[model samples]
Target: MTRRLMLSYVALALLVLLGLEIPLGYLYARGEESRFAQSIERDASMLAEIAEESIEKGNLTALPELAREYAEDNPGARVVIVDRTGRLLTDSAGTIPTGSTLAGEPDIAAALRNRTTVATSTGTNSADVLAATMPGSSGTTIRGALRVTYPMTTVTDRENRIWAVLALAGACIVTAVALVAFALARWITRPLRTLERATAQLAAGRLDNPPDADSGPPELRRLAAAFTHTATRLQHLLQAQHGFASEASHQLKTPLTSLRLRLENFEPYLDPRAHPSLEETIGEVERLSRMVHGLLALARLENTATTPGPVDADAVLVERATMWEPLAAEQHVTIAITGPAAGRVRAIPGALEQIIDNLLANALRVSPPGTTITLARAPGAGLHVIDQGPGMPEADRERAFDRFWRASDSHHDGTGLGLPIVRHLVHASGGQITLHAAPGGGLDAHVQLRPAGRERRFQTIAVTHAAAGHRR
Candidate 1:
């Protein structure tokens, strides 16, 4: 856009220069030609008058000598005398023979008819010439005709010089205009570019600091203000929602606990036929309670800002694997771990643990009996979870990470919130997670995070317990 604006300015300037300078140049040349002709006419008339006087005084020889002197004084000029019957008497430049009948030239012809005339010379010898002719007379008697000619090279040279100056000036003006246009374009667009970056940062949920709204054009400044207003409103709405989810989860847990206790106490007295239905109801209530707790944890993670620090990847994987071992063994499944003893990555507090717990739970839900689940870490702060179970279809991979999404053919009774939670935590910690087909058959989940220099603590045992309780 800036380039287009500057080009538009330069194009308009060029058009204006062409419109103004072309005619100006032509008029200047014409004016110089007219002035040169007028000068020649004046010189011819003066010489003609002198010739008439000399003729009347019977001093014909004096005329030739006067013409010779005039020609010598003014270089590149010619003088000629001719009789009324169109015969040349003398030639100052000696180009025409004396007494030769050569009054056929247009200016000489006009002077023989007793009228002054001015015309440009042409033909082989006329390179560029201005000629003026006048009839020499004495007391109403026309004497011979006098013709004077001057080279027009000087007139053309002056016009060329004028055009050269105009060309230089036009070039300078266009160059200056282009530079000013570039500066102006940048000035107008700089604020817009800055606003664009600020908008992107705001979209990524980093609203702790607002963009400066006072630095651009009036319209853009107003836009910045609007953006800031919208961002503040969004932050307030999210904070309110997070607070409500947290408070609501905490408030509901007490009642849910009471209900579970009541169900347990009443189970002994319930009939055998009614026991399964009662147990199912209790399970549903527990699932709801787990979902609420998951929501609260997600809200907290979303609200929490990730600090720049390292996490103990090795410890996190070891602890999570140990925690899930008892449940895995109950299903006749084994857990395998591989990686360095002290892997490190940049992550928020409790982030890696939450991610590992969710992925491990998700993997356990789908793994077949006696199958081994592989937990491994690689260089570059990468983690992998490979499950020996029926993996989802190719098209369902991305949708699996969406909240409340589950595979249509799956037999597992999952709340379908695990991967979404994992994905959110991974992103918050500046990492990425992807689900792919495992080797042979099953699901493979991969996570890559920024490498950190040293280890730090993880604090997500409460969240893990909450999710685990629901699964059991």
Candidate 2:
């Protein structure tokens, strides 16, 4: 951003310099050439007047002397005088014969007709020359043509110098603009960079380095102050939530457990017909207890923030399957491990084990005796807990992640938070979880986790340790 801003400033400066300096330099050059042409024209006209008397009387003796004196006064100038009959009378450089025919030259040709002319042409001594030709006339009768030629370098050198100076000045201004623009860009973006870091930290559930409200522009300052307030309020709310979860963990579960135990204790003393009602009441109490615990667990999970790191998905799958094997055997159900290995997957510390445990437990609950519960590693960084039980409808699968949403045909005592908690953990690990029909007609809990390619600074042993609600 800083670089882009600086370049923008420099580009704008260059545009302004080109717009101003180009025309200024061009006009100065044109004005210099105009002034140069006027000086030559004035010199030629004055010489024409000087030569008028000598040429009119046809006295050539003093004309050569006059031309030589004029040439000596102005360096790199050639003077040529042509008579009325198109013959050179005298040459200032003495190179051409005095009677040489010099009438064909454009400036001389125009001047012979009593018209004055000034233009640039090729020179014997240089590549370019500016010549001014005027008729040496007496009483409107043309006597001779007087032409004065100066090297074009006389005017071009000044034009070149002016352009060079303008270019240097423009370059200096552009350089200065770039430096100032760089400084200004940095100054403006420094506060934005601070805000960016603060926003990222806030999104990750902590704001370690809060932005300074008074350090930047007024608009940014106000935004910083608002962000700080929002972060403070969020921290306070999370703290209150954590406190509530901790308190409710003990308060809510104790009464529910006591109620279930008290109701069960009355089973021996109650009438036979009352036993059914008592059982149902106890079951409701147990379900309520599970619901309270599930909600508290969710609250606690949401209160803490964690970054996902590499975990050996295959190892966790095998370990979980082994752990749940005894429960499956007790129900005469077979637990089968299949499929290829799911390599290192991204998961929060100890989250993979909890996810696998929850999915397998749910699978085993619906699975019938003599049926196989398959624990498989799907393609890529994925896992599947396939069971031989009745699969849910497509609509129910979509709402399965909602808290306390139970399937209509669910028969077992469940709090209906198993799928929700599983989804929460999966999503926190940057993964997706879905329920599909198994091959033989059961629910296949398909979980797709991100692949952890590089090593990170985390305790990889956490993946093998116990997970939340692992024992329960």
Candidate 3:
């Protein structure tokens, strides 16, 4: 943008220079030519008058000496003297023979007919300005004709010099304009650069360093001020929202636990018919307690920002599988850990453990006995938790990340926040998660993670989380 602005300034300067300089240069050239031609014509008329006196006296002896002296005084000039019959009498520089006939020349012919003419003539080696005049008093009383020729280089050299000076001045002006333009562009854009950095930091989690609203143009200053104010307000709102969710969830836990205990205590005291109602009340309290924890976890996840790092996929799989074996054994189901070592996968701290834990719990809730629940890993393909249980339909899987959404046929008591939490963690680590139908029966929870060596850059996470937050 700076380069573009500078170019625009320079281009405008050049256009203005061309408009003024072109006509000025052309006028100067014409003036130089006109002045040169007049000088030569005046000299030719004076010489013609001098030659008239010598011809009238019939004394030709001093004519050659006068012509030679005049030619020497004027460099690059040629002079010729001719009688009324158009026969040359003397030549400056003596290039032509003494008796040479110049009657065929146009300037000499016109001069002999008692007329003055000034024009330019082009020769093989050079171009010249030729001036012709009649001698021995005008009006067909000519004794001889005198012609003067001067090279065109004198006027052309002057014209060339003026053009060079104009061009140099124009170049200097453009250079100066370019320098000023560069500084102006940088000054105008500084606020935008600061705003860009602030926006990036805000997206990462918080706006620690906001844009400076005191510098640059008035428009940009206003923009920076507005942006800083908006980021601060948004930060405050998010902090307040996360604080409320966290405090409310934590506050509800103690009461719900106490209520469950009190209801269970009532179970033993009540009659047999009331025992069933008491147990139902305790179950509902437990369910409410789990829901509060899920919401608290979500709030914490949204509030904290952590850097992702490499973790051994195979090691995590083995550790988590072993921890879940006892529960599977009690259900008469086998916990099968399979697949090759997947090396290191990138994930936020504690994210992998929670993701695997939630997936395993869901699997175990619906998993049948005598069936194998597989914890598998493959290189580049990431981790998978496959269970031999009833799988979700395509429509339900699509909306599984929506908060508090559950399948209509699901009988298991769940808060329906598991899939949504897994999605947030996966995306925050620059990874992806999806639910697919297992080969024969049950569900496959596929978690795709970036290799640790890859840089953590993910825009999808922000968009996904925003949608999820809105739904919640």
Clashing pairs in 1: none
In candidate 2, what are the lDDT values of residues 1-472, reduced to their tens digit? 8899999999999999999999998999889889999999999999999898887776788889889998999998889988887799888988999898988877778888999999888887657998899999886798898999899897888989988999999999999999999999887777788889999998888899998776666787888889889998998998888788778876989888888889989989999999999989988998888888888878878877899988887887788878888998999988787777767878899888888777777766766678877665545444566666766667776777777777676667878887788888888998777666556566656676777876342212111111111111
Kindly list the per-residue Cα lDDT of model 1 for residues 184-225, writing each as its tens digit. 877767667666777777767666556567775778778878
Candidate 3 segments whose C-alpha is farther than 4 A from its true place = 1-7, 33-137, 140-157, 266-283, 311-346, 356-398, 430-451, 454-472
lDDT of each: 0.76, 0.79, 0.78
Residue 314 C-alpha lDDT in model 3: 69
RMSD of 2: 5.3
What RMSD does each model have against the real structure? 8.0, 5.3, 5.9
Each model's total of backbone clashes: 0, 0, 0
The TM-score values for the models, in the order shown, are 0.62, 0.81, 0.71
Clashes of 1: 0
Better of 2 and 3 by lDDT: 2
Of 2 and 3, which scores higher on TM-score?
2
Most lDDT-accurate candidate? 2
Off by over 4 Å in 1: 1-19, 22-201, 204-229, 307-353, 372-384, 429-440, 444-472
